[model samples]
Structure formats: C-alpha cells, structure tokens
Target: MGGAFVAAALLARLGGRIGLPTIPLFILAGILLGPNTPGFVLVADPHDLEMLSALGLVLLLFYLGLEFHMDDLKQGGRRMALAGGTYLLLNVGAGLAFGFLTGWGTREALVLAGVLGISSSAIVTKILVDLGRVGSPETKPILGIIVVEDVFLAVYLAILQPLLSGTNGPGDAALKAAKALAFLLLLAAAARYGTKIIGRLFDTRDNELLVISFLGAAVLVAGVSEWFGVADAIGAFMVGLMLGSTTSAKRIMTLVHPLRDAFGAIFFFAFGLSIDPGDLPSVAGPVAIAVALTIVMNVLAGLATAKMYDFGRGPAGRVATTLLARGEFALILATMAASAGLNPRLSPFIAGYVLVLAVLGPLAAGRSDWLARVRPGEPQPELVGAGK
Candidate 1:
C-alpha cells in the first residue's frame, strides 16, 4: 500500500508537468508495478480497497453535479433529450452490427452494444472542468446529454443484472425490468425531495459537517440502489444530480473538494492496479477494434447531435471531437463484465483504451477553441452565456 501510494504520487506529479491527465499515468504505473510486470511487483488486495475506490467514484460524481445549476438542466433539456437519445441508438446499433459480425451471442451482443453506446461521463466532466470549459455553451448540452446518459446507464445496468444472473423466461425479465424502473423512479424522487431536506441541513457553514453530509447522502443512495439490485454508481450519480439542482450543491462541493481529490486519486490508482497484463496480448486486437469503433460512432453521433442543435460545423466538430473519449462508464462496464464472468479477456483492454481516451479527450477540449478558429466556413465560436 505504501509503495503504491508513492508510485502513484510520482506518476501524478510527472503527468501534471507534461499536461497529461493523471489517471492514465497512474494506470501505466500500476501496469508496470503490477503482478504482470517484471521490474517491480506491488500488489494490494482489491477486496480491501474496492470500497474506498467506490466511495471515490461517488464523490467524483457528486462534484460533477455541483458544477451545474438547475437552469442549465431546464435550458438544455431538449438538446440533451435529442443528443443523448440519438447517440445511444446509433452507437448501440453499431455495436450490435459489430457483434454479429464478430460472432458473439445475442445476449453478449446486447451487453457489448450497451457498453459501447455509453461514453464516460466521469472522464468528460473531469476534462471539461479541468479545461475550464464546463460553463461553455458547447459543454452545457454535452453535460446535459451526459446527465441523461448517466441515468440511462443505471437503467441499463438494472436490466442487465437479470440477464447475467441467469434468471430465465421472458416473464422474469419483464418483472425485473418493471422493478428496476420502479426503483429508478423512487430514486429520482428521493433526489428531488430528499436532497432538498438534506440541503437545508447544511445552512450552517461548517466545512466538516458539510463534507460528512455530502458523503452520507452518496452512501445512502448507493446503498439503496444496491439493495434494489441496481448499480451503485448509478445511485450515487442520481444523488449528485439531485443535489446539483439545489443552490447549495456548489457549497457542498467546495467543502468536500479536498476529500474528493484525495479519494479520487486513489480511485484512479486502483484503476491502474486492476489492469492484468497477461490478458492484454490475447484481447488486444478485438479491444483495439472496439475502441476505434467506439470513438468513431460516438464522434459521429456528437456531430449529428450538434448539427441538430443548429451549432455551426466548427463548433459541431468541436463537440464531436470532444465527446469521442470514454472513461468512467467503460470502467463500470468492465467491472460488470468481470462480475458476470462474461469475458475477463476484454476488460483490461477496455480499461486501457479508456485511460488512453481520458488523456486525449482533455487535450482535445483544451484545443477546441483553436480547432474552431482553424476550421474553414465555420461561424465564430459562441460563448456559453452569450445567448442566455
């Protein structure tokens, strides 16, 4: 554990100096020092650390929600609906086609398609925030779309559990689906109503109290989601989204910022540690194809969505380019795949691909303005609040 911390810290510091996201570097370091690599082997028991990593992910989503205001959601509702819906449909369709061509079974195909259809909200939001583009007009719709996607991911995971757990018959599947939907509705209500009450409790400006409250809400929601047999990350994300609509979300974020960073760092490090090098050689080809297809389909989907929103080609292109990277959702899917015993061969490849995209996406976001400027026959980039 001590060795892992020191290595992670060194990698993070080096990554910062080179303008790379720390997550990828942490992953690389883990791969190097992990059981797979020969130079230095530092393996920690994952069972001991999984809870901490999970908490970190929860805090990460909470911070993402705090960054947005209710008005952002209200204003971008239509765009989000259009963009998120279309993106999911197109990417899932593409994934199904690929799966059929690759000879995967129907069930596996659906799982694969669902995995590919989702982009990394955690990664995208973090990149946008780091780049100071979170408040930009382009980002508003993108994030709005991501918010919707996060909900969809939760629902999808709920649907997937029955399929993976070997619950037979269409009746069982339908019943599970209904139960999942009911649970989701209940969760939304809790976010809307329960968070409001929780928000009021933070009226006093005690930072420690605020942090505890914020984390407590995350755990409560995650626990409830798990009890309902839905994915914990989904529950945590919903909690954040609910708090996001409240005026005090930002204050809570501010209070928990340090904790979030520390735990979030550990989360990424754990991600690194989880990659198994032995599996890479076997899955490399398929994983590369999957990653490439994911980037292409998502980018096109983003472009199509941007055009529908009446964004000019350059801005639309920027949006498409920026949205191509995947991170958190991919990690979540990899975790699900591992749990299902579906295909351990594919998980590390997907994880590595996601880490690579995490690095690339932020750099693209950082260059979006320059890209827009350089594109011919494109309108000037519009500031996020200009029209509003």
Candidate 2:
C-alpha cells in the first residue's frame, strides 16, 4: 500500500503532463507491481487492498452524488432523461452487437454491454469539476446522463447478481431482484423524505460533529445496502443524494474531497494489482478493438446527447470527449466478471482495454477543442474554444 501510493503519485504527475487521468496511472503502477511484472514493489497481499479499494470506490460515488443535487431533475428532467436514455440504449446495443460479432456468448455479451454502456461517473465528474466545466451549459445534461446511468447501474447489478451467482432457478432470481428492488425503492424514498430528519440531526454548526455524521451516514448506508443484496456503491450514492439535499452539503463536500482523492487512488491501484501483466500481451489486440468501438460509439452518443440539450458544436464535441473515460465502474464490472467465474477472459481483456482507454479517454477530452470547428455561433471562453 505504501509503494502503491508513491507509485500512483509519480504516475499521476506524469499523467498531468500528458493529459491522461491519474486513475490509469494508479492502475498501471499496480500492474507494474503485479505478479507478472518484474518490479521491486509487488503487492504481497491483494486481499488487504480490497477493503480500502472498496471504500475508495464508495467514497468516489458518494462524492459524485453529493455534487449532483437532486433538484437537477426538476430543472432538466426531459432532456437529461432522453439524452442519457439515448446514450445507454445505443451504447448497450453496440456493445452487444460487437460481443456477438466477436463470438463472445450471450452472457459475455450482456456483461460486455454493461461494461460498455456505463461511463466512469467518478472520472468524468472529477474532470468536469477540475476543468471548471461544472457550470458550463453542457454540464447539466452530462450530469443528468450520469445520474441516469447510475440508476441503471443499480438495476443491472441487482439483475446480474443472481445470474452470476447461479441461483437455483427463475424463482430465485426473481426473489433476489425483488429484495433488491424493494430496498432500492426504500432508499429512494428515504433520500426524498428523510432529508428533513438528517437536516435536523446533522445540519449543525459543530464542524467536527458534522463531519462525523456525514462519514458515518455514508459508511453505514453502504454496509446496509450490501447486506440487502444492493451494491454498496448504490448505498453510498443514495446517502450522498440525501446529504446533498441538506444546507450543510457544501461543508460536507469540502470535508470529504480529500478523503475521496485518497481512497479513490487506492481503488484504481487495486484494479491494476488484480491483473497479471503477462496476460496483457495476449489480450492487446482485442482490447484495442474494444477501445476503438467504445470511443467511436461514445462520441456519437455523447454528441447527440449534447445537441439534444441545445449545446453548441464545441460543447457538444467536448461532451463526447468527456464521456470517453471509463474508470471505477468498468473496473467494478470487470472484477465482478472475474469473481463470478462467469467469464475469466472478460476480466483480463477489460483490464487491458481500460488501461488504454482510461489514458486515451482523458487525453482525448483534454484536447476535445480540436473538433470544435464550427461557424462562430455563440462566443465562448478561451478554455472551451481551445486547449491551453
């Protein structure tokens, strides 16, 4: 873990110079320390990394949800839903089609579709915030799309868990899904109505108590979500949504940002630690093919989404680029595949693919202004018009 931190910091510095995300760098550092790589700092115990990694992922999702206020749907419901729905449908369709074309079976194809359809909410949201695009015209719809994808993420996992676990029959699958759905609905209702209770208890002036309350709520909810067969990420996210509704949301966000970055680094590093670098060589070709497909599809779907939201060509193109980076969620899905024994090859293949695209995705987004060649319609700021 000590070595992982040092390696990630160095790689992140390198990534900053090259317009890549620190996530891929973190992962690359782990891969270098993996069994297959002849590195001085190999990870001796992968299990120890799992809990921290899970916490990192959970925090990342929670931060994202916190940043995205629930009021957004009231402001931009139709367009956001339509645009996000469009992206999901198209990307999933494309993923399934490609999976079938390449002779990956139905189950593999479904998993692949999930792997393809979802973008890394953590990465893209962070990038947008860092780039100061959080207030841009395109941001509203982009965030909306992320929220929609997250909703589907919970549903997909709920449905997939039973199948992957090899439950006895259809009855078992239905029962598991019912349990998950009921829990999720309860969570949603809590986020809606329970905010007042939280506001009363936690919306206080005591900064230390405030911090404890926020962290405690997120972690407790995440554990409960896991207990009920719902993904812990979902629980953290829903907790975030509830927290964000409070008057103390900004203070909570400020306090949590540092924690998110620290644990988020572990999450990415652990992904790389899980992979055997020696296996990457055999998977490179397929990984490249998959990357190409996702990039093209993301651009198309993302562009349409931006246009539907009435963004200019430049912002639309930028939105497409922003959508390219697939981080935590992809890794999560890939890891799920590996754990279930449903598709061993899927894990390695996706690990390699994510390494490349994770880098390329951010690089492309950083330079997205190259595609902003349009008649000067709406005057834009220097950053939106041209890359610095």
Candidate 3:
C-alpha cells in the first residue's frame, strides 16, 4: 500500500508540474511499475489492491453525491431528463450500430453497446472535482446523465446476463432488473423523505465517530447494492445523497476529502495495473474508431444539452469533454465478456478504448476552451457559472 501511494503520488506530482492531469499520470505509474511491464514491479498482483480500489470508487461517488443537492435536481429535473435521454439515444444507438458493423455477433454487440454507451461515473466525478467544475452550470446535467446511465446499466446488465451466463434465464434477468429498480427507488425515497431521519442518525460532534458513521454507512450500503446487482458506485452516491441533506454534510465532506483523494488514485492505478500495454496494439484500429465515435457522439450530445439549457459553446464543450472518460464499468463488461468466452478481441478493444479516453478525457476537459473556439460562430449568451 505504501509503495502504491508513493508511486502514484510521485508520478502525479511530476505530471502536475507539467500541467498534466493527475488521473492519467497515476494510471501510468501503475502501468510502469506493475508486473505487466518489464521493470521494477511494485505490486505483482493487482488483486492486492482490489479492495482498496473498490473503496476508492465508492468514496469518489459518495463525494459526488455530497455535492449534488436536491435543489439542483428540482431545478433541472425535466431538462436533466431530456439531456440524459439525448445522450443515451446518440451514444448507445451509435454503439449498437458500430458493434454490429464489427460483425462480432449478437452477444458481442450487446456487450459493446454498454461499453460504448455508459460514461465512467468515477472518472466523471473525479474530473468535475479536479477541474473545479463541480458547481458549474453544466455539471448538474452531466451528473444527471450519469444517474440515468446507472439505471440503464442495471437494465442492460440484466438483459446481458442470461445471454452471456447461459445459466440465468429470462426470469432471472427480470428479477435482477426488478431488484435494481427497487434499490434505486429505495435510495431515491430515502434521499427525498428520510433526510431529517438520516441527519439525526449521524448527528454527532465527535470527529472520529462522525467519520466512522458515514464511512461505514457508505461502504455498507455500497456492498448491499452490489449484492442486489446494482452498481456499488451508485449505492455509495445515494448514501451520500441521503447524508448530504443532513446537518453534518459540510463536516462529512471536509473529512472525506483526504480519503477520496487517496483511494481515488488507487482506483485509477489498479485500473492501469490490470491492463497490459501489449494487448492494446492488436485492437488499436478498432479502438481508434470507437474512440472517435464516442467523441463525435458526445459532441452532439453536448450541443443538445447546451441547447436545452441555453448554454454557449464553452459550457457545451465542458459538458462533452467532462463526461468523456470510460473506466471501471467498461472494465466490468470486459471481465464479463472474458468469463462468458465471447470474442477474445473484445477485451483488448475495451482496454485500448478505455485507456485512450481515460487519458484523453481529462486532457480535453482541461482545454475545453479550444473546443469552444472551433469554427468561431456568432456571439451567444453564456449561462451563469458556465465559464471555464
């Protein structure tokens, strides 16, 4: 753990000096020091970091929830839905079409649809914080789209399970989907009506006790969520949401910063450790095309979101680029594919595609102004809190 911390921090610091995002640098540190590459191996087994990495993911989303107030939800409710729906229609539809074009078969197409469709909530949350855009005008929609995708993921995975696992029947798939829906609704209800009750539960002045209560609740809820077949990250987020409305929200957020930063770095590092650079080459061409497709689709989606919210080019670019990274969830799909014995190339394609965008997402977001400058257009009204 010490070695992982040192390596990640050192690389991130070095990269920070050069104006690079710490995210990709942390991943690069893992790739360079991991056993997959020829060099000093800091950690021979990525599994050693798995639990910590999962905690990192949980904490990241939990922090995101803390920042996303209910007022934002009420204000952007309809527009958020429309923006999220537009994003899904463009990206998921394109992914399915691209999957079929690859001629990898139906199962592969189904998997690819998810891989290409969902944005990495973990990465997106990190970008929002790193770029200081968490409070930006477009962030509400960006997060709303992520929430929408989480719901879609539950249903998509339910559909994919029977086809891939062979053991799960349509009945099993329906049950899983139902469980996911129930879990989300349960969380939503808690966030809506149980805020005061939740506040009372964690209302304490002791710093140590406060940390223990919130951390335990977040992780426990996240674990329960996974058992119920929903994304653990979503579970963590909802936990944060419920707690964010509490009187202790500010205190909890203050305490969580260090934990979120530390664990989040490990999450990215573990992600890099799992990927073998050699595998990326074989699927480079396909990955390139897929990355291009994601970028183009995201741009269209961003424009649609901008139009809906009356945002100008800068905010639209920020919207597109901020949501660009694909990480943990894509890897989850890759693991499922490998276990199901689908196309072998699918794994590498996902790896290469994720790595490129993971790196590119932060880089692009940092320079979103460049996107705004593309083909200079007529002056437009800028939305409040939308500037870079």
Candidate 3 regions off by >4 Å?
Answer: 103-111, 120-167, 310-315, 327-347, 366-388
Best by TM-score: 2
Sort by TM-score, best first: 2, 1, 3
By summed lDDT, the worst window of 10 consecutive residues in model 2 runs over 379-388
Q: lDDT for every model?
A: 0.69, 0.79, 0.82
Residue 227 displacement in candidate 3 (angstroms):
2.6
Cα lDDT for residue 302, model 3? 88
lDDT of 3 at 388: 45
* Ten-residue region with minimum lDDT total, candidate 1: 379-388
lDDT of 2: 0.79
Best of the candidates, lDDT: 3
Model 1, 115-211: lDDT tens digits are 6777766567666776666666577678767766765676788787667655669998787777767887886776666766756765667767766
Superposed on all Cα atoms, the candidates' RMSDs to the truth, in angstroms, are 4.0, 2.9, 3.7
lDDT of 3 at 314: 82
